[model samples]
Target: MTGFRVLFRAACSRVEGTGHLRRCLTLARELVARGASVGVVTEDNPLARSLAFSSANLSVHFVAPGCLFADLIDDVAVVVIDMPKTDEQLSLHPDWIGQLRQADRAGVSVVSLGHVSASADCFRAVIDLYPSRTVHAVNYLEGPEYLILRPEFAASDIADGAFSDQCEANRVLVSMGGSDPQDLTGTAIKALIDTGVTMSVDLVIGSGYCGDLQAWQTQATAAGLELTVHRDLGANDMARLMRQSTLALVAFGTTAYELMALGRVAAAFTHYSWQEASAQRFESLGAIRYLGCAESVLSCRRIAEQVRQLLADRDAMAAMAKKGQALVDGRGACRVADLLQTYAQETRDRQLDLLYVVAHPGDELMGAGATLIRQIDEGLRVGLVVLGEGSASRWNEPGPSQDRELAQRGLKTALQQVADQLGLSAWYYYRFEDNRFDGHDRLDLVKVVESVIRRHCPHTVYTHHPADLNIDHRLCFEAVITATRPQPECPVTTVYSIETPSSTDWGSVLGHGVFQPNWFESVAATLERKLALLELYQSELRDDPHPRSLAAVADQARYWGRRIGVPCAEAFVLQRHLAATISEQKHSERQGES
Candidate 1:
């Protein structure tokens, strides 16, 4: 309940295969490590049960084959579907689509895996782990960068001197995934025997496999080979076998990716046409030798010949091993987990109506904290960005006593607590020197602001007025203006300038510019929360009568609200506003051109 609840719906069966389940398990393991509660929904097969039993944190939901999942979509943060069987099946599955639609309507995010040919509009995002040339929809995350691999496979080190020509080659690994409906394992074993090589064979058979295990053992013994058959091998055991073996003959799927991660030279074949693309991609990358479909007799002979040649030619095997290792660094699961985390964060951020760009850590709370809390109460996402370190006052004190670094660290911690109290969807800080904006290059400041704006892509932006007494406040206003300028692709449709308690009021006496308010947001319900959050910045708070004093801040909110006939409110100067339609049209035109 503390973390995200992710439900994985995979296409798995004894007759179909377990590749989808295996990949889902890899991602599930990563998610669990990141404090997620994972549930897997698949057919009640031996492999599915085995996977569920292996992970203490995983909950298994057994669905009958060709039947819809039961009512379990509520309360899930994310629903990840890994149905690599077929696009038609994914699209036409009534229960699958209904669950996804229900989750989508309930504000839960949905992600699809290996959805190459399906319509991507049903889900929030689609992930294609293999190298693909097809142009997908905007929500698709394609290419090898998104490949998901188990932690053991990802953490295993590449074999030392594995590519050396003088390295001894003795053992070969033959694994064709959890349920080889076409009996590719039997074919691979026979092909290895036909090679007539004097090497030990490590055959890994899945629990769900319905092949004749006794016949395979007899054939291996008659061919004068030392065969070791492993059943239901776990991830750690598989990694150990892959490391110990000199070469692998695997069906093109998750197993091939595992072998590649371990830097094992492999000749990959496909049992299904859907796997050809992945096999050819690995072959082109020199990571594996593609032996075509395993069902073809000629392809089986080719697999045998390739095994013979690779064993005899140490340099070729080493080159292949090195290439395979180089292609898959084993950190792909981490990358994918990061994306999922970001997507979850962005799901919340998408509801934000405003992003406050401030010059110091406590500026937002001191300026428009009540307004932010009010917006959140009204179900709007609110974000914060503090551009300066806010420690210049401590650093510039007359006494050389305080540790400036320590003071800054404490200020940052206080800012984080304040942000949390305000329920900010996203918060960022740039530790630039406080009150020293004049000393830094303006272009650098602009670029920094631009990056944050691009990331949050908020519909509305709030910053300081340009005519502020504080140099950092004035510069931050200028940078925000430049960063959120009306561009064809920019998401900012409206920008407002708010008054910081110390900076905005002090500038009135200088006659530089008056702090005039054109907008007032009632914060009567949240003024107490705002004041409470402001108290966290003890280093920045002042005694009564000072402009930044707690009492004065409360009085100012009442004063602004009284002018607008409200109990309490925050004031803002409307700087720029654009129609949402105009921005959307420009964005669409730009996308079309691209």
Candidate 2:
């Protein structure tokens, strides 16, 4: 299946804080891993920009403050909105709900993260990891099972023995979300110092924090406290620091969930009234000690006393850790990914038009790359499939027993680049042996192609010509034909066989069936993209006279273009094509006869 293109819109800034941005990035990472192209559209806030840059393989777009949602909702299949919570209301601009309605009417799938005061009817799905009440909607995914923790936190080992020996567990961690706009780090540091327990402190401040760092360092030094200040820490580094600390003083947001994921007992404080629900919920469950709002006058002294008492009582600290771990297991991002994929599949079934299945990793680019690019540029959802591992090219090389592993790894990297360059909505790779398709049972290959057809439900299918010189290409064509045979359940309406630059043209003297192309697709605009993708598979390129050289590829495109009276073109043989009306008529006739 091809990946979906998603747009994530959130509010983030020094005042709004970075929780919304951070959580959105977490979800984006998971979606990207599942082969979705994720773009984050948010306010032009420094914190949001910094956090977006920190995430690899993500596209970030910044909008001016008060920009209409319609301005940022272009060319996306799905849109995720993450509104900041402050006071008692979600930080949604006046036009957000109206824009969401517009997006819904535009056929774009809309999802809302966390609770919002507006009616949920505008969204396709509503996700609140900690829903205060049962949402009676079928699209609502609530409870701790859907908690979206950073990947590092989800993978980290929980601190099951963090408080086993309170005397030795003297390290305290203090993090008040990303911005800490209220400058609560200083207060938390002061409360930690007032404990008078001679504990070391690890303080995390986000890049959005505009506090006086030097003054805080001076105060900690003068107070005879060992304090290490960290800024802009990555997810893994933060998880590592949390594991080394005995207690965490954090705000009631994503950070609190992270602490719970690591089973670190924390004294949670609310930076906003909207955060009080989560804080008090955790406290009531004995997972954390809620210390009211950080702005309260008695909060500093009360938090200090609570931390001191918890450190002194090993049993109490351990109990808290146990309860915290039980509350969150940290697999929410994957669950959310699954839901997004379902939505994407549904969208594609309604909107997609083409699927290209090739025999090997580079075959898609080598055979019909230009055509695929042109189709996608024309607003068609193009899916890709590579049936073989493409590892046989190195099978004869002299190397360690792990040569196969190395080849597979190299091919996987190249194919991923190809997928990204083509902007495919979905991609699938099978591990059938390269150049040795005959070695496997033919039924297996048929089943693989059939499954892909059923999943993607593409209207048009492209594969290699059956007469191609490559054995794998021949087998792939056969499999596609068998799998896509006319059936009431199969949505495939057409199948086109493309010519590989090397294989199709080289079989002329072998007396094999010729590739007689009757269909020519103009690819003048996307010929460069095809060439660029071919370059990514450098290992597969052959020298001059081999017909697979870069120069030969361009020459072939020119020859085909000249034949069709175009600047550049790709040739294809239309093996089968059925109009929807005719297919429905055939089905009706068969049912009547039965």
Candidate 3:
């Protein structure tokens, strides 16, 4: 999980618009903040290049136009598609289907932002930011809550307290998205003129706007409407203008969501069927007033009347603003980042070779720490799971709650350091009561162990011996046994029981079965490193005469080494190992019958 990577593939141009690439940049910043290395792949266009240059930390790769999704899946864990559902983009590469199959076969996860035409099933996840009422797929993440708006729109210092009915609202903000491919900005201006209301109009246009601005200015002057045109404003300046406006007249896109996040009531117009679907959903939430589709000639009149009604009735505007602000919290990027990180970690954990389950803090170090280090050095991926709090046993009565919390925090920090030093692929620490394993039901421990076993899917597992004097150690052994019970789906094929020094030594005196070792691993090179790591748990070590002491641990290593004819070794009793020859034996039987 050290180099978790994500690559975003999006399209941008005069026709496709720049919203897809811009939103990907916003989400990329959030992923980088969470320690993910992010890159963006988009068409080599002027607008995309300018926007990409603004985000300095992100690695941007420019591809030829209409070939944005071709040959871009490199050493990344996940590929996010933010392209439109246009017919031209979909038909650009005939081998798009085969490319997706190859990525799947190579263990790469593909996620989509918005619907891809005729290929929804090819994606691992479809994040529809503007979804309709019916659920599309089980993996489809929907609604305005997942809208990826810039963080500036959700700042704390901008106060949108209440709309005042006493003061007549005059300012109106108009933006027709990055590219008004259908010239909806002209329709919005005509609608504003038809409203016959005296208000200051602030028109915002993006880099892709190709309309006749001079003609629009002439018409506004003739209509006696006060108009100020702002071109290509950045996020901070746009947010500043949004804060000053009482209402927004916008096309259906990222601007609509930004208006909702800022509580600026907006009446939306749509050019595409998908945009209309999103508008209807937002209108149903009382966030925006959806004027019917802009494709119809009469929709202009509809927008005109709605603008008149909204300007006249301040109470309705207040209600709409409150609902819109409450609907979007502007943290969708963070949620999406969390989803990608989880998938990346799971992808990494599936390659694990060994997992060690223990009962307490220093138990792993005392038992098979040297062996764990040796296997990891030989390029075997290893993980660790601690099942108890490792501290509450020090208290006589139920200890002060705050003191226990502090001790638990310290132990977690120490485990993090140990995992880093040992280069473990994954590690988890759970807090079952320290020495109270007997008080809990046996099934509960089995379920927890089973859950971890299913996630990591290690080929070999190591746990405490069943004959240990400690109650937690005995229960831990039982849990691992039941969790790894032989089934066709279980990845575990071998299980070994390692001896903890003090607990295993005292078990024989109390009439419990002694640990008889049948497997010994040479740890001549890693024994010193294991002893160094034990210093992290100094509170758990004792004097020279005790079996848990540092000198006594080295002496025990020598004793096990002498028995196995090695300089140093760790001994284990191999309880179970399901040999991997069943498939071979079945093949031989079928050949003989033939």
Cα lDDT listed for each candidate = 0.75, 0.76, 0.78
Tens digit of lDDT per residue, candidate 3, span 106-222? 666677787643543345556677654333211344555578888888635356534444335579999988888878888889888999888889999887788998888899879
Ranking by lDDT: 3, 2, 1
Model 1 per-residue lDDT tens digits across residues 1-594:
236677888877776678788777778878887887777788876667876787656777888777555767666777777876546675566566666556665667677776543443346666667533442222444444456787787735544525543337578888988888888888888888889889999999987889999999999999998999999898889988888888888878778877777777778778867667767867776778987785555455667888888888877777888777766767778876765675566655345568998888888988788888888878787777777767865555454322443465468669767866777776666556667777777976787666556555688999998878998898899998998888897889899999888789888766668999999999988888988888899999999999899999999999998999999989999999986588888997898599
- lDDT value, candidate 1, whole model: 0.75
lDDT of 2 by residue, 168-257 (tens): 658988898778887888888878878888888888988878888788889888988898988878887998888888888888778888
Pitting candidate 2 against candidate 3, the one with the higher TM-score is 3
Task: TM-score each candidate.
Answer: 0.60, 0.57, 0.60
Candidate 3 wrong stretches, greater than 4 Å: 69-72, 86-92, 116-122, 133-138, 155-157, 161-167, 351-594
| Candidate ordering by TM-score (highest first) | 1, 3, 2
Q: Clashing pairs in model 2? A: 1-426, 1-427, 2-425, 2-426, 3-425, 3-426
Regions of model 1 farther than 4 Å from truth: 155-161, 164-167, 295-298, 352-594
